[model samples]
Target chain A: MEEVASKVLSTKPTLFSYFRSSASWRVRLVLALKGIEFTYQAVNITKDGGAQQYSEDYAKMNPMNRVPALFIDGKCLGESIAIIEYLEETRPDTRKVFPSDPYLRAKARQLTEIINSGIQPLQNLEVLNKIEDELKGDRKEWAQHFIKKGMNAFEEIIKETRGKYCIGDEVSIADVCLIPQCFAAERFGVDLATFPNIKEIRDSLTGLPEFIAGDLKSQPDYVA
Target chain B: MEEVASKVLSTKPTLFSYFRSSASWRVRLVLALKGIEFTYQAVNITKDGGAQQYSEDYAKMNPMNRVPALFIDGKCLGESIAIIEYLEETRPDTRKVFPSDPYLRAKARQLTEIINSGIQPLQNLEVLNKIEDELKGDRKEWAQHFIKKGMNAFEEIIKETRGKYCIGDEVSIADVCLIPQCFAAERFGVDLATFPNIKEIRDSLTGLPEFIAGDLKSQPDYVA
Candidate 1:
């Protein structure tokens, strides 16, 4: 920790995140895997009606008012995928989010999208509240439904693409998205028994030290 | 049409699209801006419960079962942001989806996410149907609400980011996501008068011949 902190002494990146945020976890996994040092600034999304994210000061940095905004390279970056990609582009390392081949890169990205755009937003905290309060729908059940449906597709993609990871041998962005989403799914009581492919890949990823460190319960701000 | 066909003799891209699909339109804008020739295959998402996107054949190509899956470089790509980034990466030319600078690239992508994930999925056809059939909510009102909220954020981002286009004088992927989202918002009865910055940027992009060619009514599959 001392050595890593010394290396990142100049303008250390600060990640504004919430402990339970799946998107923040995605960025955390990437930063960990890339071996980049960053400071974690916990933004409690459950407090003050998520007012921390929407406060005038925070909104100026990320107009979307979402956590997991990375302050790096002298600018603030919002959106987990965007922040990860920016890190990948600016700070290139041995491990990459996308592979070298264009087709394989597309494959990794396709999987990233399956979670980033396809599944996550439908079951985001805000959307779930809308379902429960305004729509009078069971938020948990609605979340379970989308997670199951998306996991089905994700498992199929994993079945076809997996080797040591979600796409071939490397740990691409797909694995980063997969781990957090599975965590979110389980929280909503989604049955992962049928998604053996996703389970297998996730089992492999979550075992890694970096993956373990980035888990929801392991964060500095996490509470029972 | 014949001349355009002749120009793209070998390995022309096939874009699975629907005339009114905002996600599909997003990819369309990028292909057009980059002058990358592609054949359009309309997968009528509004017909037969979006079955065309879910067909075994299409699912094999894109497991997420969404349109704007680009069959290019001998592979299929889904998710508009991912597809556009792939194109930007592979088809490196003077016309790029993001600017040359890394920070600027992050800025472009931040706007892209602001629309791609923030707004579109909230007002997606499936979500709208869910709002109506399951939630017993007025779809139009719901669409308007989300779109307006997102656009307000979008307008702020645009105000800070815009030059001649969304990011700068050059057209970017931010513009690509912006045009389609504004188009979708208007369709859902979202009045654009409040979004002067977005309206101005859309006005500039829509005036170009390439952008005009990518309009909803101009696509080969348009009806009514």
Candidate 2:
């Protein structure tokens, strides 16, 4: 533990991310909450004709060909939720993203998965593009449907769990996941007004410096 | 910890599961691997006009209206990964599902997310049904495409990390997640021949009693 911690402490981190990618924003938020400064290496997933994430180098770093891959301790890690949990585990002393109580922690994770797996994956860029280009479907409607359905559940869960944040005032992984999904929700034209609880939670968290630092607009590669 | 564990130990668990739901099977595998006995309360997701999961009763337990909501310690928990993590944390003395080493644990989680978020969600029953019914898209083609794409990434990551299991000789959450996904992959007509590493690992793990016990065919609600 000491050896690994010392090695991690000595080396700065590098985040490979995209400005509008919700998953990328999740890792950025975690890094902000942890106060772990790192070099930001942007991977423009939408710019190139084929997307930079599909390039050989980026694919080598993340076989999933996705953004928000963290290069830390001389190793590359991908997957937003996994990277968030890794940060939480390694730096426990930092702002804790998980709850201290067992049930609350489980609830926080449950809420996080509502966004991570339930909402975000369904409306991700790859899925949306596939729906439009190949499936000849309305990508906007598809994204809105799933996002609204997920937010309905998320709103329900948070209504019982909220106290200023998703899990009783602490800024948990649930909150980290929520703010980005809400961004995607509005982009898809989903009416956030339908989910009052989610709207309230999003409003409360977006003003925090940690969340602000992770906002899509504050990103290094932001366009428009 | 003692208070929670004692409460948990005093009461037997009840798993609300579907016969072939990949997410539900994940929690079953964890419970089996941990040697925890739980009552199987089958919630048929396919029966009647609407799935039982969407019923008012089940929705009260899990607003997501998903199967495999584990009722344990006097609380209902949803999200298979969250339930798995809760079990791991609350019962550390049981047969471990996460790797002890920090980095290995992260890798295990990364691989799990590759399936949990990347692959499974894309090919899930709801997504497939939606593609077929509303979008008029070829659901099988959609499932096959996402499953194969995700398997390609899953195979790539495990190649660097595999050693009898996803992270090492011991079975980890990665392996638990992989087995169910392979089940879905085969169902979607994804040839296991392409992902030999995943196939090999899946083959090695399925013969174990714990996995077999969690097999869809082993479920109370299994049809065929």
Q: Against the true structure, whose DockQ is highest? A: 2
Candidate 2 TM-score, true structure as reference: 0.95
Q: What TM-score, to 2 decimals, does candidate 1 have? A: 0.94
lDDT of 1 at A33: 89
For residue A94, what is the lDDT in candidate 2?
A: 89
* Off by more than 4 A, model 1: A1-10, B1-10
Worst lDDT 10-window in candidate 1 chain B: B1-10
List, for all models, the DockQ compared with the true complex: 0.70, 0.72
Compute the lDDT of residue A187 as modeled in candidate 2. Answer: 86
Error of 2 at A138 (Å): 1.0
Clashing pairs in 2: none
Error of 1 at B118 (Å): 0.9
Model 2 ranges off by over 4 Å:
A1-10, B1-10
Estimated TM-score per prediction?
A: 0.94, 0.95
Which candidate number would show the highest TM-score if scored against the true structure?
2
DockQ score for model 2: 0.72
